[model samples]
Target: MTDTDVAPDTAAWRTPHGTSQSVSQNHLAGEVWMLLRRNIREALRSPVIAFIFPVLFPLFAETLVASSYARVSSLESFPIQPYTAYMAPGMMLLAGMMGSGYSATALVLDVQTGFLQRLRLLNVRPSAILLSRIIFDALRVLPAAVVVLLVGLALGARLESGPASVVGLLVMCSAWSVAYGGLFYIVALTTWNPQAPLAMSPLFILLMFTSTAAMPTSLQPGWLASLAHYNPFTYVTEGARALMTGPVTAHALLPAAAVLVVGIALTQGFVIPLFRRAVER
Candidate 1:
């Protein structure tokens, strides 16, 4: 056989190889599943420390505030039932935030240990890596949400909306989880200093106090009320609260969507660059 005869066979083999590589690139399904499974196993093996801060702190806050607030007739409008209901979703968000924070910390560790570099070299889709981390964080929040819901029920909380609405509420909360996780991804990428997130922890606590979680908007001081009007967290808490209580308002959905959008945009801005930097190394 001459070179011309060999050339066609070589081309044929190259074609199949290229096609296989393309297919492999597109299909990261196995990689994502494996990553998710590994995350779950690690979570299960770990101590309940993650659960303690996200789950217990919120429950403790609800218990303390509900008991104290129940006593004052002046605060009767914000009763235990509605108050606990209002606070439940905030707790859910907090759970997600904490989950994301811890996951980011882990990512930082992976970066320092050079595991992230190894991940970048793999055939796995670039998106799959970030998505897998978010999925892991979201899964961590699920049990905490369940625990909060049970506590709410025990505290006389009830959902006025039907099952569909409840599901919507869960979906919205999950979106917040992913959005917040994305923000953490940014933090992880920009700086390796653990203190960066620790410094901003107070902002989370302040968000709860500024929102409708603790009291009605009407009851808030004038300046705080104005601030709450623009706060995205208030929208989420109110959206969840409206679903939990009677008199659902369409307005709540708008801000919930807004927060989700804004959160996504802000997260992407940081995450994309961070991802590129990681891949470059």
Candidate 2:
């Protein structure tokens, strides 16, 4: 009911001799960890947004594409043996993309419900608030990434590389998701509207379709090929493909890494300031 009534262990207190004091400092790392756990638990309670769609949508897309386009692998010019193998990396990336926006939407909901204000009242740092959500956003897609990879193997994909590359590929997918989802955070924080994130959902489809996700650029029409050349996700997909299939060379990985780094830097450069202002408002 009052500070005096609070347990000493959980609250700041001075020794009887006044020789020392225990400060209940809201450390950034500790606060972020606590809030990240809360976010994960809350998401698990509503698994549809946090889990189901992320896994299912990518699985469906991969299966549907592989089934319809199985003949592509038979072509002499095709890169991989089974078309499913080629489709696997892109599908994993798509899972990362699909699993995003939940954090931004959740953050907006928290604001609307006054939960963020409550956290502020408790002296939680703004950086902790935003960083926890960002980390949660990256972590939430991991299950879907794993599921899609397993399904790809089941559907006739092969892992030419060893287990280490698989881990690297998954990590790349999570980082890509964080970068791609930055737009949603910017929109949500800028507008303070839950619906704003939904409007950006079509960008996922556009990115996949316009890029070399499902098909190589050589077979694409002139316009589509031109688009694929500039689409950053194409590099991500190709780099992921190299990791899973073969030739884990710098040629593929470097461009993807650079694109990811720039995407993350640019979007977060905007998002951090925007989120801080939003929460402080």
Local distance difference test values of all predictions, in order: 0.66, 0.84
Q: Write the per-residue lDDT of candidate 1 for residues 177-237, one digit (tens) a residue.
A: 7777776667777888654654555566777778776766777899989888877778877
Candidate 2 clashing pairs? none
TM-score of each: 0.82, 0.90
Q: Model 2, range 1-281, lDDT digits (tens) per residue?
A: 22332233123223577543422274688878877877887787779978898888789877996899999889887888799998899999998888577888888887776676656666678888889988987898899999999999999987888888989898899899889999999998888888889778778888998888889988789999999999999999999999999889999999999998999999999999988887778
Q: Which residues of candidate 2, in runs, are more than 4 Å off? A: 1-24
Quote the positional error of residue 43 for candidate 1 in Å: 2.7
Q: For candidate 1, which ten residues in a row score worst on lDDT?
A: 5-14
Clashes of each: 0, 0
Candidate 1 stretches greater than 4 Å from native: 1-26, 72-82
> Which of the numbered candidates is closest to the native, going by highest TM-score?
2
The candidate 2 region of ten consecutive residues with least summed lDDT is 1-10
RMSD of each: 9.1, 4.9
